[model samples]
Target: MSFKALIVDKDDEGKTSAGVQTIDESRLPEGDVTVAVEYSTVNYKDGLCLGSGGGLVKTYPHVPGIDFAGTVEASDDPRYTPGDKVVLTGWRVGEIWWGGYAQKARVKADWLVPLPDGLTTRDAMAVGTAGFTAMLAVMALEDHGLKPGDGPVLVTGAAGGVGSVATAILAHLGHEVAAVTGRPETADYLTGLGASRIVAREEINETVKRPLEAETWAGCVDAVGGAMLARVLGQMKYGASVAAVGLAGGAGLPATVVPFLLRGVNLLGIDSVMRPHDDRLRAWGRIARDLPMDKLADMIQPATLADLPELGRAILKGGVRGRVVVDVNA
Candidate 1:
């Protein structure tokens, strides 16, 4: 059988090009299972893979989707069968391997994790990789002894997927939430998601001349790095931790490490890719239970495969808000 797929390729001159085209099952790579994919999503990474400067896809003719949820159609592994539901987030699937921007995908048995009990395939894709990373950030804070009573938790890039979900999850858990964003229009959106305070982007991006500021936040989930990360480091409460996730701002940390040394602050780096299978499952399980579904309705905006190219540009420019759930078969 044949199906519609999005494939990017490079020609003889090494020029990159992408399009939606028809492909046969024979084009699929080696795997233990073949899935009838129902949903995938657009992440910052997906935007990178689709964009001209996005470094995610080094090889041509690639299908760039980092997150997917579906049912198995064929399997060589005994643990899986045609009826089981599964989801994929990392293992560098979309970057190093062919991913879920197609009707069907064949992947290693080891790369698959059973969908969490409370989430449907659609719901799973709604959370996607970004939400999973947010959950890990929240879990990291929890693991480091952060609690609601300790102090307010700040979520930078609060309008983005990871930040929005992180804010909601922390607020749902009864913690005070301070959401920071550059767009003033998104203040209500962030407030609606349970943020108790709305902070300006400029307040978090200014140059840090001092080693430490007033003990501002107890913990933080920062998706925007660069100057934003550097500023947040100084604002944290004594011995508090910050989970550094995305690099939407920039890759460089241009500030001193005086906050870390002076206050006993910890900077927890979150890398969802190459994470142990057990940890991924646990994170997904927590997301299914903790993240508010009704709130996700506002955070989630659905798109088709055809919308990916435009979204890729929007996300890179920091224009996108919340999760972009791609209905792959739509």
Candidate 2:
């Protein structure tokens, strides 16, 4: 069967090019289940894989979508059968294996999760990998003893996909949310997502030469790392923890150990790719119950396969303001 896909291929001069292409089902990689992709999503990783950045994709002519949701078209594995609604995120499928920026996908049955109730395939993709990661971060923060009564939780890069969802979820959990963003225009957007306060990016992106700073945040869900992480670490409340989820700012951690040693602050590293199955299920279940779907619909921006190239570049530039749910069939 012929299908349309967003295929990225680089040239000999290291110039990268990407666009939609027509390919055959026979070209799909070996897997136990095949899905007719209704929706995929754009994340920072997908942006990188679609372009020449991210350092995640090591191959050429790749399909760069880290999250997808649809119905199984066929399955050789007993775990799934044709017409089962399913979703996938992480497990490095979009990076190392062929992924879901297309009309169809064949992936290991182990990577598939039956779509949680109260979520359509489009809704699932709207949450996508970024939203899933945000959920994981929220869970990690709570597991670290954070509560809504624990003072204001900070969400860095609040306008971005992961940060936006984190802000909404934290606020939904009854936490006072402080959304940090460079763009002043997103204040209303963040507030609509339940943020009680909006913090300017310049306030927190300072060089962390100080081992400690005046404590401002009770806890943090950080999507921007590098100096932001270092700066936020110093500003966290004593005995507070930060869930470090992304490196949109930068990867280098120019941090001191004073927060850990003196303040008892915790920096929890979060990885969504290799998450254990049970944890994934629990997170999805919680998301279905806790995430405000009405608010989520307000934040979703739809795209098609043809929009991937521009969307990829926009995400890298930090221009994307909300979750982008790509309709592969569109």
Candidate 3:
């Protein structure tokens, strides 16, 4: 059998190009299960893999989708059988191994999770790795004692995938959500996602001389690290927590300990990749129970496998909003 895939290859000059191509079943990577992939979504890492490899994709002619949802076509593992619905994320699948930018994917059974009861394969990809990570962040915050009505919860980079999902989840949970975005045009969009306030990127993105400020926010899900994180540290209310998710702004944290020491503010690092199976199940279950389906639907922008190359570049440039669900078979 053969399937269509977005195959990325590098030339002798080391430049990379990606396009949809027909792939034989014999070419599938070694794995315990074979999935007929229904949907995949573009993430920042996918952008890198689609373009220049981003130091993540090591092999040429690689498939580059970090997350996917589908039905099992075959399985050697006892935990999954043919016709089982499954989802794959993390474990560096797209980065170090062949991934799900195709009509089919073969992967280790350990990396696959049964799709949560309420989410369709399309909905699973709509949440993708970005939204999954966002769910992890929210869980981390809650585990660290964050609660609704403590004060306003902040979501930085609110228009991006992680931030968008975080904002919606926080709002649905009864928190007053303050969404931060550089694009003023997205204010209405954020509001529709239930954000009570829109904070301009300029309002909290820069480094501040003061280590502690008004202590405004009760909790934060910060996607933009670097200076924005540092500034947010000072603004968090005493005893508050911040789940550090992405470093889209930058990797460096130019911060002080005043917020941690004096205010007892906590900084919780969230890592969705390589999470334990039980933890993955917990987060996905929470997502199905807590995250509103309508909000997730609103976040979706549909695409096909042929649309990936352009969408991949757009995500890297921070030009994509909400979620982009790719129908691999379309």
Q: In each prediction, how many residue pairs overlap at the backbone (N, C-alpha, C within less than 3 A)?
A: 2, 0, 0
What is the RMSD, in Å, between candidate 3 and the native fold over all Cα? 0.7
Candidate 3, residues 229-310, lDDT tens digits: the string is 9999999998999999999999999999999999999999998889999999998999899888899877899999899999
TM-scores for the candidates:
0.97, 0.97, 0.99
lDDT of each: 0.89, 0.90, 0.93
Q: What lDDT would candidate 1 get against the real structure?
A: 0.89
lDDT of 2 by residue, 59-175 (tens): 887887888999999999998988899999999988988898999999999898889888899989889888898999999999989987989999998898889899989999999
Best by lDDT: 3
Top-scoring candidate (TM-score): 3
Indicate the worst ten consecutive residues by lDDT in candidate 1: 51-60
Clash pairs detected, candidate 2? none
21-119: candidate 1 lDDT, tens digit per residue: 889999898999999999998887877787653666777778878888999999999989999999999988888788988889989999999998989
The lDDT, on a scale of 0 to 1, for candidate 2 is: 0.90
